[model samples]
Target chain A: MKFNHACKLILKNLFLIFILTSGVHGNENVNDKVKKLTLELRCMTCQNQSIYDSDADFSIDIKKLVKQKFHEGKTESEIKKFLVERYGEYILFRPLINFKNLFLWLFPFTILAIVTVFLIFSARKK
Target chain B: MKRIIVISPLIILFIICLFTLFYIIGNKDPNKPPSALLNKNLPSFTSKSLFDNEIILTDNDLRNKKIIINFFASWCTPCKVEHPLFFELAEQYPDLYILGFNHKDAAKDAKNYLKDEGNPYTFVGVDKDGLIALDFGVFGLPETFLINEKGKIVYKYMGPLTDKIIKDEIQPRL
Candidate 1:
């Protein structure tokens, strides 16, 4: 009985050590991930300011939340999608190509098409 | 006749461009008119002064004081550039209470920043959470808000405050 109790105590201590060490290691990973992602997300309310730029209390809270989400094993895409869902694509200062934003997507091509047609017509006229 | 027609279009375009430039210049006054929030009371929120631990600043605390509230952060490069301008304002307006709301900074870093850079604020407060900034509708760093003695915000200026702002607009208004 005495030997068994001693073995159990040792196992508990080892388990505690593993938990503490892994918790710290996990926290560092989450912090790194959050910092990396934040550098990309623009603060929509602040023109030309990245999420990392303004020290607004909310931005810091978001940074902390991002770290927490990362620790939950969310992928970068998942994290970005979550922010978009909450704040809309406005949170991403860089506009993305989509059906709703089809004009934004189509604009360059539309301009090219117009230029090409004009060139062809002009050449034919000449 | 062809030259006259071509030259007229170019002159018209040049005039249009010149008119547009003047329009932009007129509208670009950093000290925005008080119309944004003429009679609105100040948004109530709480923050700790980055300079002193004992001083806790709240919206209610600003009542009956001509206050210049500046939002800034240690990491923001432009904030550093605008710091001198802020100092100039503080020096000029002794009665004007300059409050530095340090958003999203560790208290230690804020204290250190004050130590390194001359502390211009009458009180430096830490917006550790950023709730205060949101209440004031702060979307950017280095944004300054002018609040009247009654605690109503008279104007808000986005981006860095410049010498022209101090001399031409703010000083004249005061």
Candidate 2:
């Protein structure tokens, strides 16, 4: 029983070690970076889904381009800026906080502030 | 004071209603996504000509002339609808260059479609992998971009071209 248990434990460790070492090398780092960038990019075809979550042809092309750009030594920001320059700010899953979209970004916070002020005044009245 | 407070919300609602009405009345085609390439220089790309694979077309080829870049695919139904309009425009304005960027389509099918529909394009480039369409930020097929002689994109139309669009929007610019 002890020999059988020891053999099973050895096999499990060997399997894990094999899996870990196999993926630790090569372009895995770049792939992770590409995945992170793709997650933030809105899939233009789907409109509502991120490229990472979409299987649309455009999303697939964008992912390939992202990985290729990374391989070409472009930084994440450069890739994002390139995409934004072509696709506009709409391609970002999060709307860019710019002068044009300032109201869009601030509206929720502004509403919260107004509600808080109203609550405080109502509490005082009570 | 209580009456004033009660009336304030009603006034606000009235203003909101007025604003909504104004927006609905003022804007046409509210569903059209704003083109990012408007007023921007054409995105540069190189691709093989759809008609002749040996011929390459670059951004420079599209410059020095007022051109209409139409994104189309043989599979897109709207493109077929707009096909005759392009032919009409091509004949009406011989100086105006109509370049077709075949998006995400097989080369053979694109050739066949053009053959059947009557090719109006001065040059057709195959965007087989859709990288060129991506450069143009094209979300849908049958999107048209009008580039001025200087190679800057002046206008974009998102859907099938109608006679009204040609007369009202494109004719004035041309």
Candidate 3:
């Protein structure tokens, strides 16, 4: 009975914490939130630019979409995922390291390790 | 014959190294044009002044002061971050002329936006048509071109200007 009561109290505390934190941080101005998130997204076509970079008519339209998403109260990650769904993975500036991109993430370090090992082995043999 | 065979590989490797170096340098910044554009006369065009809708600012009028031309749009996010820095820069370089090319925006919207956000520009030009942007080879908004007093393009930054760049990169050139 005591164990069940303790677990209930812990759950209550966690719920209260969630409510307080979300109330404080979640009420950011919709425009500010959207502006902050847009810069983090990459431009689809323009090299090394964010969606917020280009003056293309399409970019302006995307900004309008972002403003709409803000009103929907979606999180930053949710907005990014929605963009990725629409435009594919190419929309992101920093590609997420996942199962599909595992090779890309590991290839650079693997090549560096191979080179170091080859150099050490060649030197020791000599 | 043996010496030639061994040296042949070495010479080929040397050529490959040189080619690789050139390729790396070439691909470093694809947006920046060749050095030929630098020190060339600023392109001439007439654009509606952002400050006054009826008035037009000619390229010839821009010859006297060292100007920093920023391409920005109301929809651009990085332009928001770059906006406050421009205000600080205007404060620092009172004599420095800062002009903005408002690419494809309504004059009333641009003016109202600037008024609300703090107008950092000395003069704003409406590029309702992106012809002016094309002349300068602009691929994106928030790009900055620093022109010398003689209207020669001295420096161009393809991204948002940070405090470090203002202090370390641009102030020295000024």
Candidate maximizing lDDT: 2
Report the lDDT tens digits of candidate 1 across residue range B1-174.
955753454466567657857865775543332233445677777776665678787877777899888888887778888898877787778899998899877877777777887788888888876757655656567778788887877767778888887777677656
Clashes of each: 7, 0, 0
Question: TM-scores of all models?
Answer: 0.51, 0.80, 0.55
Could you say which candidate leads in DockQ? 2
Candidate 3 structure quality by residue, lDDT tens digits, A37-102: 777776544666776767655466567678777778777888777666434455666777799788
**Native contacts retained, all candidates in order:** 0.10, 0.48, 0.00
lDDT per residue (tens digit) for residues B1-174 in model 2: 965764565466567657757865676543465787899999999989987889999998776899999999999999999999998999899999999999989888999999999999999988988888888988788899999888889889988999999899898888
User: How far in Å is the alpha carbon of B149 misplaced in model 3?
Assistant: 1.0
Best by TM-score: 2
Between prediction 1 and prediction 3, the one with superior TM-score is 3
* Cα lDDT, model 1, residue B86: 73
Q: For all candidates listed, what's the TM-score of chain B alone?
A: 0.76, 0.86, 0.85
Instruction: Tell me the TM-score of model 2.
Output: 0.80
* Interface RMSD, one decimal, each candidate: 8.9, 3.3, 12.0
Cα RMSD to native, each candidate? 9.3, 6.0, 15.4
Worst 10 residues of 3 chain A by lDDT: A82-91
Query: Which lDDT value does model 2 have at A107?
Result: 58
lDDT of 2 by residue, A1-126 (tens): 999999999999999998887767547898899889999998877857899999987788899999999989999989988989888777887877789888667756765665576567668767
Off by over 4 Å in 2: A1-26, B2-31
lDDT of 1 by residue, A12-115 (tens): 99999999999999888777787788988876555557787767655776676677778788998898876664344656766666787886577567656655
